[model samples]
Target: MPSRTLSAMDDHDPLTKAISPPPDETAAEKEARVKSELEAKRVSDAIDDDIDKQRIAEKRGPKPVRVLLLGQSESGKSTTLKNFQLMQDAKAFRKERSSWRALIQLNLVRSIHIILDAIARDYYPSSRPLMKDPNSSSTSPSVSPPSHAMPLPKETYLDPELLELRLRLDPLWKVQEQLARRLMIHESQWKEGLHGGREVVVNSAVAWKDVFTKKMANKRESSDSGRINWDDPTDPGRVLHECAEDMKRLWKHPLVQNLLEKQNLRLEEMAGFFLDEIDEITSEYYIPTNDHILKARLKTLGVSEHRVELNAGGGLGRDWRIYDVGGHRSLVTTWVPYFDNVDAIIFLAPISAFDQVLEEAPKVNRLEDSVMLWSSIVSNKLLERTDIILFLNKCDIMKTKLSSGIRLKDYVVSYGNRPNDFDSAASYLKKKFAGIMKEDSPLPRTFYCHLTTVTDTLSTQKVITSIKDMLMRDNLKHSTLLL
Candidate 1:
């Protein structure tokens, strides 16, 4: 056979025949078909052109200042992010007040549960082991039952009044479960060992705020007044309000306090502690204020990214991206992928945790874990050039612990015979972190250190302002170098 050309073969193709015009097609049909095809081609070309323009605009636009926040659990990473949002977008922050109310109420419920559990444990010693002495050198400060399991006796002696309070507050436990599920925490996540007892842990990807907001919106739509109906029997707030006085009595009982002291279970030191504000937090009309929202604790499973547009300081009218990653030991490896492109890293070390231990790794001291995490971040080759800021966080808590006669030498043996005051201890820990960055870093970078109680709005805002100025100046310098 003679050589067959590609075009000649295409003419006989099935697709070509199917799309071909009818053999008896009119002249008007061809004219109309040509116009339709031209119109479609013009529309497609316009879309392509618009896409190219958008890509070029994105390339030429100012690059956002990206900062990665690294820390172990409860190191104030989320608090710091909230501070940024508060300062940059106060309106948006306040808009979510109702949503935060649910979390604060949940926190209060959890604290109440802890107190009741303590009372039960004290009454029925055979039911569970005593809480570990956090100050002990041999054991972790995290409150967990002993490794040995013990069977409960047939009967135990609990105060009649306390028993009544516990019984009346039984409904709060169901409210806790409801709020957790509403926040997108599945029963499986809890059963699979993703969270500890009554601790709320949800993935960052879940729009938890919307869960509350959408519900409120529907309720508001049904009501004549555009306000949440507090009278709804299903609202968790009602249960909390009804049990308010009993909860207050339970929290303030002298015997309860004595038992807590004996067991070294400082509920105030833990995250989501709201026992002190039961009267205000459990009110039917309760709404979370800025401070309440800052102190409220909700453990997140994955990384959360927040964007803020800055209009003040060196980088005026600049957009910034802050990445808040989960700080649990199991989640640490997930942070590596975000390290490569970040402009700076804010590593929080909760120095106040000198006497406490990691919940995930009970044997390891929390402060020591923070040090190890800091070392890993600074020494990573990928993060060598990125600016690293050290926040020796929880200074306020450390001060209280020191004032209460908790000796630094007892836990940090290296501090032998030094003054056990807050200033001396904070300075010592800051130096320790500085030394690690200096010695272990892959490259020499400036060490920026701040002693912070991130929940303190005025102080934290001042620190945030300084950080913004420093990062913007450095970013400008880098841009100049690129030129």
Candidate 2:
């Protein structure tokens, strides 16, 4: 066996002199080196922890394709949201249906307020009235009465039932005034341009916390005889039910009907439309169905978000975040932030609104506003890749309007008295959108068009299903983790 080689001696040899053994570490130096190593390890571990946190956050958070619902006021955006909930979270929607009772109460009260204003207008003779009415009650007051309002204060014609309804629902009328006052106060708090600022002018007013409480109590009264406890959680529906018979009488009275006619008023044309269905809606344990919820019309303010878990085959799929922004011209400015990161935009254009003008600025036609708004959207560079769907909403209303002799030519002017039927008018409206899209859209977006009554479920469901499927196909190709 060969002898094992030993360390070379380096005291005198040149080759050995070139190499040296490591010097023995001093205690202080060793401590310093160890301290430096420990700090380096701590930094490394801290960096790893940060990376892990970021990874976990990315994993745990919802990976939803955000969709923004864009449209002008009364274009059925809220109704579309309800349809989505019905398809995805039926139980949740059912739960929310009961809450509409208070809103309908507020609505009934609002109609009374309008009638009161009309009465007050005809009650006295002057350009100025007893009170400067805060706002008109019509959801769409574009059409004036025959330009000849009938004479008023036919007190002999007013029914006792009318008087009773006007009295029983007085508390709710007071509630509306209180709500309107609260809304105006919060209205100033609204921030401009989509910073997630909210307007409490509509549905939110119903949700105001402790909203009905009196600010300064009256101690002098012996009893709260005139008071109505609307805050009593269980009895809102009961109150309307109790007054149902009287409500029907009030609505059916000849003089009352004449007044509505004279004012060209149709309560069904506005929101909170329960006057006709008091018995059915106010029955005990009443729960609204998907259609009832969607059919609900309120001049809703602010943005609402609904989250849904998509289904792929039989399993829960990706999360979907849908946003519905306020559609009024004043509220339109609040729609931009929602555009960020949005993958799809469902735009509702009331094609029949060609005859109607803006409630805010009566000079601008509603359909014209829709066209200009559509043009701005399609042409916007911020939404270059966002898929666009146009819903020509209120086909039911459009058809009714056409048959009632509201000529499209009278409003459109360019129509030149074309065929005055549903198909012709609808086709013309479709062409208007198509023409605008062709001329204004800078992107090669595939336009999905549908004629929707918004209240009709079967047809709207078909369109909703088609869009849902397409969205799944397009969005899932990129999200391969999805089943």
Highest TM-score, which number? 1
Q: List the residue pairs that clash in candidate 2.
A: none
What C-alpha lDDT values do all the predictions have?
0.75, 0.60
lDDT tens digits, residue span 289-336, model 2: 555666665565677676766565312466667888874765765465
**What is the alpha-carbon lDDT of model 1 when measured against the actual structure?**
0.75
In candidate 2 the C-alpha lDDT for residue 458 amounts to: 67
**Candidate 2: 10-residue stretch with minimal lDDT:** 190-199
What's the lDDT for residue 71 in model 1?
A: 92
| RMSD in angstroms between candidate 1 and the native structure over all alpha carbons | 10.7
RMSD to true structure for each model, in Å: 10.7, 18.5
Q: Supply candidate 2's per-residue lDDT for 79.
A: 81
Question: Against the true structure, what is each candidate's TM-score?
Answer: 0.79, 0.67
